[model samples]
Target: MKTLINITLLSFAMLFMSMLNAQDTVKKKNGEVLKVVVKEINDSQIKYYHFDDPNQVLFTLDRMTITEIKFAYGKEYKEEESIMTDDYFTEDQNMVLSLSMSSMLFDAIIISFDKAIDPKSGFQITGKLLGIGFGPSFENWYNRSGFDLEVGYKLKFSGLKKKKWEYRPNHLLSGRYIMPSVGFTTYSEDRSSSQIKKNLIHLGLKFGNLKIIQKLIIVDYYTGFAYFGGSKKRTLNSYGSDVDFEYNDINAGDLLGSGNFAVTFGFKVGLAFGQYGEQKEKLKRRK
Candidate 1:
């Protein structure tokens, strides 16, 4: 409930601010500049006004045209570059403590699938909130959901030095699954069953894009190795050599255990919100 509320309030505030600035234009020191008026923002390449600007002008982002974003009044983003560079993320040690949330279209496992196994394979929207600190490379905490924590590490390499892009492969040791039950009875000789979960290990690759005109935001396309899944497990009876199996009404705990290799592939898109400025990233881009 707390998480939901926080997310709601944050979203509403951001949306409102964006709307209020739709007609405004922002200017920077360098020849590169941005124009913000009311609820609109105009850049050297494109202009965006209102939420749904059908006649909006869009421009191709050019490396040379990119410059540090300056705000009128006293506005700030979530993260800052000086904090990332002069301190943690810098030329000698490029690292950052990052946080993000994501939604996915499909999240499935690599194994073969059928109707039963793929029942929950349709579509899922999940969130990832993690902080990774880098030193030699980058490493930190991966907090998935409710104590589903993991020790994560990542290594990244850029395809091009001038663009705002990066490819990273990350690995993490995640907590086990703690399944909830529905209702069922198991009579496997000794009547053993499963409603609990287990721990897992996973690896993933993320292609990331960083946008720094206003805030430090990240948009990433990601997929992982172990496809963790959620389901309502139900345990029943087993049949004899020639007899038929039987089942009975059960509670949440009656649900049995099953291999959770995720119904579909592990995929999601993530975004990071900030309340400060990133000076270091700006300097790097200019270079």
Candidate 2:
């Protein structure tokens, strides 16, 4: 009788141990751990039920919030190990403010704003404040003023799933892209004897690579060509001598020129604001 009682107790203990081993464990990023019976897992979330509850009430949690899951059958799923197949950009990382370095060479400050519509595409606008920098001061000879505006559509060709598990999460707008742009520029120089006015309309296509550093700084390098069409006109006063009129050549190191067709190549450097800026501030506070 004593042997039988011991045997029966051992059997019950083994059954309880087996039941405990059948449960799954969920670990959250916030240091919470839960024992559950996993029901389903999709791309964005996971569905599960409490292992200890009698009613088995279902619960759902975002996959981003979870760190890992240890299954009952000795399998494991880690959130960090999963590959991002689509939509790599977050809402906070979608907008960028930048300045063109090459534009400063032409005595202009070109400020650009890019807003991402989706993970793969976006649009940008650039405003040029001409006659600000110290490229070639025309103040001694003539007063110069101009306005330039450009709008472009960007098609991103990176960070998408070309192969399995090939995307990096921090690569926001860091890759190759093709941009088609249209721009208009107008300039007027006022002198005592003559007034010179020039206008330009250009359509361009650019291929570029954008690189992001520390999730905040951006460097963009591009080369392309533009077709320019406009008129450069001068009005002469009574005292002014009228010779063969020639327009001031728009030349940048023999690479960019003013004519029917112009070659365009430049680099831009700037900081990414919005969410990335906030994150940098938070890190400073923590330190």
Candidate 3:
């Protein structure tokens, strides 16, 4: 009787151990099976690992392309803030925020056109005009997106064996000073419509051609010039309206009216993001 009772207890223990091991093992539909050690399960994804690869793999909630991933952990977002304290934003979010702080919302009517004449000398012809200027504000000036056109050219004396396009690295220099003509003001008379000046500087790199046929290993980086200055603008007349151009003198910043011109100086840098077109693929083949 004692022996039988011991045997029954041993069997029960073995069964319980087997069940526990099974819980730890997860089988996928594919025959390429991977044992899983379940960690913490969340509403979004599952945390586990294969027997061979001990790395903690996180599966997405929707089962996206990635087969495994680590747990989605870290940070939160608030209503008023633009950048959040999340791992995903650690890379480029801060730079974008910094740009927002420096830029002021303003009314700007600018037209710029650039033409590329030589692919070897790394030269480009450019022309720009700004009329009916305004203020520079970023807080509520989202309606201000500018229009610019740029063309690049390169000239190589003996590159690509006399091929139409020669591939090499090049640079271009640019500079400007811009005065914002628009911002939050008490009255219309406090600011003028056109007496605004802006400053800008650009040191361009990677001015060579990236044509497919003449493709060489390509890598380049250009830094924006360190810029500093405040923005201000005042319009004397409403152009056609009966609005007066004089400040009430209560909240005006120093200058008021058209006759009273203020020297508002600002500096701007240029970093060309990309200058490619839809027909870019085809153009790469020849030059």
Candidate 4:
């Protein structure tokens, strides 16, 4: 009777041990399954220990290699973020404030402010402070400032997957886009005794890109051609009198291409400040 009791007790203990050994299964991309007890999951990998092992030694599996994890309770852990989704072309509605590096270096001091009217359209206005003539034009000149404004409609050509189109947001005004703009500029170059003035209208068509980092920092680069119209002249002569006309074999138009046509290239670096300004706030919260 005592031997029978011992056998029955031993059978119950073995059954309990088998139940305790059962755990979740990790499914790998290669179709292998690991019976594991997951400890933690993070952006990079999954940490777990073998369910049936006596020592229960911890192990790590690459998040990319994992297809999914299935638990005994029917819960699952799957990687949801894709590599393609992290690209700069992700759709966003952030206002961009940019400064032209080329204009700052060689031609003018240009500050541009832009805001999206929608996902596909935006407007930009630029304030420019012109530089003084360095060569034979004047002894001293000051105060050359004006504004240029334009509206753009964007067209994107990359990453068009018909299956994912409805799920993925459309980005017309971000990343690789075609940009067309029209603008007007007026500035006066004041010399010691006289002033030269300009009133110009511009039309441009360019390819452009706006890359966002951390969803707050922006880098803008574009290159295209601009057609300029209107005119420029010395309104007040060196003699301090309103001049009727000054004739030269080579006018300002001839030197600057009829004040009409030229190439346009810009590189801008700046910050996005509107709805996307929460990037900094989000980062702080994470810390």
lDDT per model, in order?
0.27, 0.73, 0.28, 0.61
Better of 2 and 4 by TM-score: 2
Query: What C-alpha RMSD separates each model from the true structure?
Result: 24.7, 8.2, 20.2, 9.0
Work out the TM-score per prediction. Answer: 0.25, 0.65, 0.23, 0.51
Q: Can you write out model 4's per-residue Cα lDDT over 5-94, one digit (the tens) per residue?
A: 999999999988877976999987677898898888887678999887778789998676767898866787775544533232334545
Q: Give every collision pair in model 2.
A: none
Error of 2 at 144 (Å): 4.1
Q: How accurate is candidate 3 locally (lDDT)?
A: 0.28
Q: In what order do the candidates fall by lDDT, top score first?
A: 2, 4, 3, 1
Q: lDDT (0-100) at residue 198 of candidate 4?
A: 67
Residue 255 in candidate 1 has what lDDT?
Answer: 15
Error of 2 at 13 (Å): 5.8
Arrange candidates, best TM-score first: 2, 4, 1, 3
After superposing candidate 3, which stretches have Cα over 4 Å from the reference? 24-35, 39-47, 51-85, 93-287
Model 4 scores a TM of: 0.51
Top candidate, metric TM-score: 2
Please give, for residues 227-262, the per-residue lDDT of candidate 2 as tens digits: 877777778886554333665444322124654778
